[model samples]
Every structure is written in structure tokens, then in C-alpha cells.
Target: MSDKSDERKRAARDRLEQQRELDRARERRRRTLIVATAVVGVLALAAVVGLIAANAGKDDHDSQAGPVATPSGATGKDGLTLQVGADDAPSTLTVWEDFRCPVCAQFEDAFRDTIAELADSGQIKVDYHLATIIDGNLGGSGSLRAANAAACAQDAGEFAAYHDVLYRNQPAESDDSFADNSRLIELAGSVDGLDTPAFRNCVEDGTYDSWVEKSNTAFGEGGFQGTPTALLNGESIFPKKGDEEISVAHLKKWVAEANKGRKPATAGATPSP
Candidate 1:
């Protein structure tokens, strides 16, 4: 009887020890799972914090829907053509040119001063139509980009100065440097008050790209070919025959003759379509 009692007590103690061991194993697993979950959550939070810190210093404002509103009193088919001088002026000199067009650069350089002087003196109204034919021909975005930048400058009331500066600093026809937005901003700085934050955003975001496309289409639909096309009083005045390299003197004389022959002047003659 004593031996049986001792055996029963040993068996009961063994079963109790096995239960205690199982309880310990379960507790260890629960602790391990808790610790792993905590570690994973902390890592995920750290990654989010790092991402926020990285983009915090950037000025990535969402682009506006379209270009700044056209400057007041400017008239054209949706600002596709930039017109200067009194609308009543006797002669309307319409010019079709692309910023990246080599010949356009030459024409601008040669006749820039005369054109500006005449327009300022109320002798003629100059209409500048932007074109991107060079972009299509040369496979670069420079023509379109530069044209858009010019429109942005127009919004700042610095179109004339900016226009001259663009032609003055025009890159080689084969080079597409103007395609870079940074370079376009650099050019804007050439014209005072043209490199503002608004202008920068306009150029970077291509605010006037649609306008440029429309102007290019207008150039084609107007039955024009190539850049540097000149029209005086709605008549093609592109140098011809022996007048291939027309001089400023000849241009002034031609304007004088056209003015002399203009039927009684009206002060509010908008450019012919």
C-alpha cells in the first residue's frame, strides 16, 4: 500500500510538470509574436517618415490648367498673333516666324530696329505670328517651347523686349537648346521682369503650348510656306526677283509708298483676317 501511494504521487507530479512545460511554451510564442509585430510596425512608420522628409523640400506645385490670362487690350485670334502699334495705322505688316527657324532669326536681326521704329511712330502695325514648323522639321521641342515662353512673356507686358532678345540670342538651327525649360527661363531673365515665378511656372508647365499649336495651324491654313514670311497690307512682300536681299531703306520706301496709296485712313482698322 505504501509503494502504490508513492507511485500515484509520482505520476500526478509528472503530469503537473508536463502541463507547466506546455504553458511556458505557449507564453514564449505569444511574446515572440508580439515583439515581431511591434518591430514591423516601427519599420513601416520609419519608411513613411523618410518619404515625407524627402519631398518636404521640393516646390512641386500642381500645374495650373492653362496659361496666365492674356494681357488686357491685346488683340488677335486668341493671342495667337501679337500685334503692336495703333490699329489705325495705314500698313499692317504681318510676319510669320519660328524661334528656331534660322532664316527667321536672320530676318529679325536685319529688320528688327526698323520694324520697331516704324511701329512706334504709328506708321505700321506689326503682327507677329508664332510658328513651330521647325519643330516638326527638325524633330525637337525647341520651336514649341520657345514660342510658349514668348507668350508667357507677353503676359508680363514684356513681349517686345522678350521677342527681340529671343531672336538676338537664338541658338543654331540644328541645336535644340531652347527645348530645355531651364534654358527658356535663362532667356526670360534677359528681359527685365520676365523671369518671375509666374513666368517660370508658365514656361515649365507649357501653359501656351496649345496656343502655339493653333498658330502653327494658322500658318499652314494661311497658305504660307517656310519662316520669315512678310506681308504688307495683306500682300506678300517677301523679297523677290532682284530684291532678294531687300534693304531696310527699301522696306521703309515700300511702306511709304503703301501709306501714300492707302485709301483715306481709318483710325481703328483691325488687321485683316
Candidate 2:
């Protein structure tokens, strides 16, 4: 072959090889794209499944029966009386609580079971007085809204259930953590037989404003300095300074002492003169 012909043939072969390499690179890219798409699809499916499982768990735990009144007659100074235990119960225990207070939450958890047991056994009656001392700290009107919503819930006969849910979902003490009206209404809907429409309307219109204000005033007048303040048989049950632990033993001792000569007062009963 002549030299020029040989050079032309070599150039043709080089061109063909380049085209083949380009085809292979395109194929590799296509395969990579396919694998990436499959991985993304699997991840999305996993996330959806996780969300469903979480929702199911929450539903199971959130289902609770309505309030169970243990029935005793005791009324606060504000004329807000609750039937706590049996009529023959020896004494009454009153707890003033703020929904947004962490200390109140701790005290509730510590003494709730004991109080419930005593109420169940017809040994004592318990009344929970809701107040809004933490309103200023919670930024929004969450403290007032929650307290009002609770009263509305109580009116609908779902107070205990609503109460439990409120504490369970209480946000941290910060401006952003305040529970809004919508959130309160949403929580009210979780309780069985709770009139959602009525609850929402009441919350929006601040229907319980007067009632909440009265309770707040009564709480202040009753000499409660802070949230989680307790009273045994209508007298302040002051825990010793630094003895913040409201253990079962201490509570039982207090109740026993309070019941020595105490009698069950009537509902809406005022404090003794």
C-alpha cells in the first residue's frame, strides 16, 4: 500500500474506536441513573411505612375512656366544686395546678396514682383547681386558652381525659412552645364524646374567660404562691423547703393527719370561716 492510503486507513480505525468508547460511556451513565432511581424509590417507601407505623402507635396509646368520678363533696372558695370520692371519705385534697408549669407536672406524676388509689378506695377525695399563672411566661395566651378549653371539656364530661392529654403534650416553657387555640381544640377532639364543634366555638369566643378569671382570682386569694400548690382538708400542705419530693409516704402521712377530724364538705362548699 502507498503511504497516504495507509495513513487514511489508520485514521478511519481511530474514528471507529472513539465512537465505540463514547457508546460505552453513555451505557454506563444510563445504568447508574437506573440504580439511583431504584434506591430513591426504596427510601421513599420506607419513610411512608415508618410514618404509618408511628401513627398507629399513637392512636393505640391515645385511646382512653372518659372521666371516672370517684365522688366526694368538696367545693372551692370560687364555688367550683368537684365530686371527687365517695361521700364517706375522710378528707379532701385540693391541688392547684398550672398546665404550663413543669413543677406541677412533676408533682402530678408523683402524687396522681396515690390520690387515685385513695379516691378509688373511698379514703379521700381529690379536687384539681386549674389556674393560669404561667400565662405570662408561655408567650401566647396558651395558659388561658388551655385552662378555658379544659373547663369546656369538663362541661362536656371529658375533663380527666383532656387533662391527661394536655399534660402529655405540654410544650417546653418557651415562647415558641406555647400551645395555640387550634392545638387546644385539636386535642379536645381526641376525647370520645367531646363535642368538637362546641369546644372549638367556646375556645374561639373565649366563652370560659370569666370562669377562668374567677379561678385565677380564687387561686390567688387562696394564698397559692405558685403552681402545684396543695391543700389538705382546706389548709395549705406546705412541703418543707428543699423537700420538693412529694413521695407517697409523705402524702399518706399528710392525708392521715388531715383526716383525723375532717369531714367531707358539700360540693361548691366554701372554705371554713
Candidate 3:
């Protein structure tokens, strides 16, 4: 072959090699895109599954128990009362509670049955002083809103039912979980005999603000610094942690001892020991 022909053949071979390299590069890019897409899809799916599981857990926590019964015609100092137990009960059990406190919820769940039993037997009266001790800008508004709504419910003669719902649907200890005024009205609607319009108006117009302030002041005067504070017959009851689960026996003993010196029909007149 002539020299020029040989050179032409070499050039053709070089061109072929360059085309092959280009083809390989394109294939690598396509494979890389496929792998990246698969990784992204897997991450998204995992995130969705995690979210579902988290939601399920929260639901389980929220739906754990049935609604507790509220007592009737339970009264307190300053006419700030709740319909928690029997009207003619011999003794009074006063509870100081903060709307935003979780321990109060636990205490409610633990003692609700006992309160119901005593109230039903006409043996005891329970009074709740709803206080707003949780303050600050984050979600303090919710605590204020709920306390005000509770006072409004009391004004409308549906305090017990509304109180039960508040404890039942109490939010976790967070700003977002605090009950707003709108949410308070919404919850009040679930009570059997609650006057929705009156309750809403009272809440909206801040008619119950004075009552809430009174309760808060009472709490301060009563020396209640934290939530879930209880006074049996006016004597402070200091509940230990985990007391809700295993402390009923102790409470019963205390009640028995407390009732020994008093006459059944005239017990409320006597101060608790």
C-alpha cells in the first residue's frame, strides 16, 4: 500500500476509538442518574413510613381512656365552683390545677374514679381552683384561654363537663399544644348541656377574665407554686411521683383517718386535718 493510504487507514482507526470512548461516557452517566434516582426514592419512602408510624403512636396515646365523669354542684371559696361531685357531700377535696401542666392530667386520671365513687355515695365534695401558673409568650395564651373558658363554663353551669373534656384532651407540654380560645369553645361544645353561644360569647368578650384572675390570685395566696396540688379537707396533700399508679391505698387510709373525728352530715363545716 502507498504511504498516504496507510496514514488514511490509521486516521480512520483513531476516529473509531474516539466514538467508542464517547459511547462509554454516555452509558456511565445514564447509570449514575438511575442510581441517584433510586436512592432519592428510597429516602422519600422511608420518610413517609416514619411519619405514619409516628402518627400512629400519637393516636394510641390520645385514645387510651374513656371520658371521666364530672361531679355535680361542687363549690369553692369566692363562688368559683365546679360540678365535680355530689351536692350534699360531707367533705371537700380541693384541687389546684394549671391548664398547661401534664402532671395534673395524670393526677386527674388517677383520682377521677375515687372522686366519682365518693361523689356518687354523697360522701365527699370536690372543688377545683383552676390556676394559670404556666406563663410566658410561647404558649401562655393557651393556658390563659383554657382557664378563661373553664370559668365561662362554670358561669354557664356546665363546668364539670367542660372540665372533664379539658383534662381528656389536654395537649402535651408545648406551646403548640396549649388550647386556644377557639379550641376551648370547640371542646366546650362536646359537653352535654353546655350553652355554646353563651360560652363562646363569654370567652370571646373576656367575661371570664375576672374569674380566672381570681383563681390565679387564690392560688398565689393559697401558696400553690406548682400544678397537681391537692388539699384534702384544707390540708395539703403532697403526692409523690408515680403516686397515681400505686398511691390510692395511701389516699384511702388518709381519708379513713380524716373521717374518724367528723360527723358525716356536717363534715364540710370542719377544716381538714
lDDT of 2 by residue, 24-115 (tens): 99999999999999999999999999999998888776675222222123255444554455555778777788888888777767766787
User: Which ranges in model 3 have alpha carbons more than 4 Å from their true place?
Assistant: 1-76, 81-83, 86-88, 136-139, 176-179, 240-246, 261-273
lDDT of residue 74 for candidate 1: 54
What TM-score should be assigned to candidate 3? 0.62
Scored against the true structure, residue 16 in model 2 reaches a CA lDDT of 94
Model 1: lDDT to the true structure:
0.82
What's model 1's TM-score?
Answer: 0.68
Weakest 10 consecutive residues of candidate 3 by summed lDDT: 264-273
In model 1, the Cα lDDT at residue 254 comes to 80
* Residue 266 CA displacement from its true place in model 2, Å: 14
In order of lDDT, best first, we have 1, 2, 3
Clashing pairs in 1: none
Model 2 segments more than 4 A misplaced:
1-75, 81-83, 175-179, 238-245, 260-273
Compared with the true structure, what per-residue lDDT tens digits does model 3 show for residues 115-212?
A: 66665555666777777777542445667678777767766666666777988888877754445677777787788767577767877876656666
Of models 1 and 2, which has the larger lDDT?
1
> Residue 1 deviation, candidate 3, in Å?
99
Q: Scored by CA lDDT, what does every candidate get? A: 0.82, 0.70, 0.70
